[model samples]
Target: MHPASAWLANESAHIEDEADEHDLHAFQAIRRMDEILVNNFMVFQDVVEEGCYDLVVGDEAWDVDYFLHENPELKRFAFAWMTDFVGWVPMPDGGEHEVALTADYNAEMIEQRARYGRVRDRSIFVGSPEDVVDLPFGPGLPGIREWTEANFDFAGYVTGFVPPTQQEREQVRRRLGYGEDDLLCVVTVGGSGVGGPLLHRVLDAVPAARRLVPGLRFLVVTGPRIDPAGLPRRRGVSYRGYLPELYRQLAACDLAVVQGGLTTCMELAAADRPFLYVPLRHHFEQNVHVRHRLERYGAGRCVDYEEACDPDALAVAMAKELHREEHAIPVETDGAQRAGEMLAELI
Candidate 1:
């Protein structure tokens, strides 16, 4: 959701309502009392200071290193997400915390080795084969690369993550417009955390695309972070505000005009949908992380924000991508359930 759009209507209430009735699924089939899995490192301090959680599992490739180094005492109660990044973890006075590390490094993680290289040998690191106490790694969703198992303590790969089936495209398309034959294009720029400008540019294309394709319907997603002040008040643009299952919309579309967010690209690819991918300017995740991953697979064409801002340039890129017929990068989807089970075992 958009971080600063609290004034806008909250559409996640339905999700929150569902969560209220959950059995702590996601670490899945959640026990009534279990360790806190910290996906976002920003809340590390809060969970630690409260000292109420039986265990707190830190789950980031890099962020957890700093969090654990600061609180050595918490290590006993910690179950951390580890990767083969080989970064040195700071230990307490010739002593190492028996921290359990889990990694599911896809191809992009292998490519981003330099990011880890900067911190790899920087004195404080305690990363060695022995430092790793391996649990089953993540399901390497969206095509993470594999390294030699001998280099790490003990890590193995599994067909972990789940992707929507090819059949989901029809279901999603039907939900968007029942019994309709309009050529719909889905435009999204990930969550509210990013894509404010990209979305405006996407909306801008709507007017032009309508003229280009007859009976066009634009599904413009305004995430929580996006302020829907200047949304196109056009005939065909459907201003969908922050759908939790936004991927369903992507599956239903004839074409996808998206920014470089891996999960978004993966979902569209799962549905066998082609897209015009516009990577965010100077953002590593967009330009570097998912960029190499997607391009390597012949999944989509790249566009710069500058070119996208120019209507003619974006149209050319969009037109070029639309002409291409096939796009498929297979990703494992069982990681959702497996990752949950791994976290659940943290206690």
Candidate 2:
């Protein structure tokens, strides 16, 4: 099950009963632990002794938050790698920590000592073959390009990300209440953390889009952590606050409008959905990730905050990327499959 579904199944009862925020969070954490326990998610065991995994892929927060709460066992054979565009997640001791399977050599030994219990016995910390060096490197490696071109529809770039299968396309349409003719759906994701600025700009860009596509529908999925107040509330725009069908929603749309966060971007790519991205100004990592993806595979168009706010520019960009008789540049093969393959190799 997806994380959101797991959350609801694990915590709905406690969440309904609790009145305090602290209590709710505690119950939620407990629910997470329960899921891990019941699933017998011995990540390390599966990776090491059983050799059941090959690779683990995600941004630092996803790696840290996920394993810390559940699947710690997998860390044994997991390659805790990272791209440079990651900001450390804050730990309870008042400092931020990189979400790696293994501690960095340069980090304070005390911090490493604290991680003694957390680090798996056998693991490697790598920067990957395609690590970005500087803005001049443009995109990373040819593999990323090969992946995109092979899987995506380049001529239909304007049509949005290509759905992997007809079934997924239908599910998305059903979920979004779209008929075959309702071709214009713009999706926005990542409601909290650094995506806030990017989301705000998208809302600001909506007016510009409405001018171009008068009947366009906006589907926004503010993350579970964010409040609806953070985004502009508009009519004709459907807001499914923290819904589970994120990939489905993106697939249903003609184009997605979102921040350059890795997980969200990866999901968009997996859905083969074309998108228009806005990199948040203060979030350097997000900006870098967006620029890298754009240069590497033409997966989507990048619209910085300032650019997204410009009515003429935003409209032009969106039109070129979303409505043209073209499709997105392909992405690496079904990333989830690739990820699973990599995990298998690791074991």
TM-score of each: 0.62, 0.56
The digit string of per-residue lDDT tens for model 2 on 1-347 reads 33333323333333334323111222123434555444333332333455454544433323343444344443643443323332222122322232231123213322332455344322221222232323221122223333333322221112123445877787768766787766555555464443455556666767777778767777766677656675778766766667765666676677787766655666566566667776544343455544664555546777766777676787667767776555445654443343334445556
Mark the regions of model 1 whose C-alpha exceeds 4 Å error after superposition: 1-55, 61-63, 82-167, 178-180, 337-347
Question: Highest lDDT among the candidates is held by which one?
Answer: 1
Q: CA lDDT of 165 in candidate 1? A: 57
Task: Indicate which candidate wins on TM-score.
Answer: 1
Q: Model 2's lDDT to the true fold? A: 0.50
Q: Please, what are the lDDT tens digits per residue for candidate 1 over residues 63-101? A: 444435544444435444444223222112222221121
Scanning candidate 1 in windows of ten residues, the lowest lDDT window is 21-30
Question: Candidate 2's error at 39, in angstroms?
Answer: 26
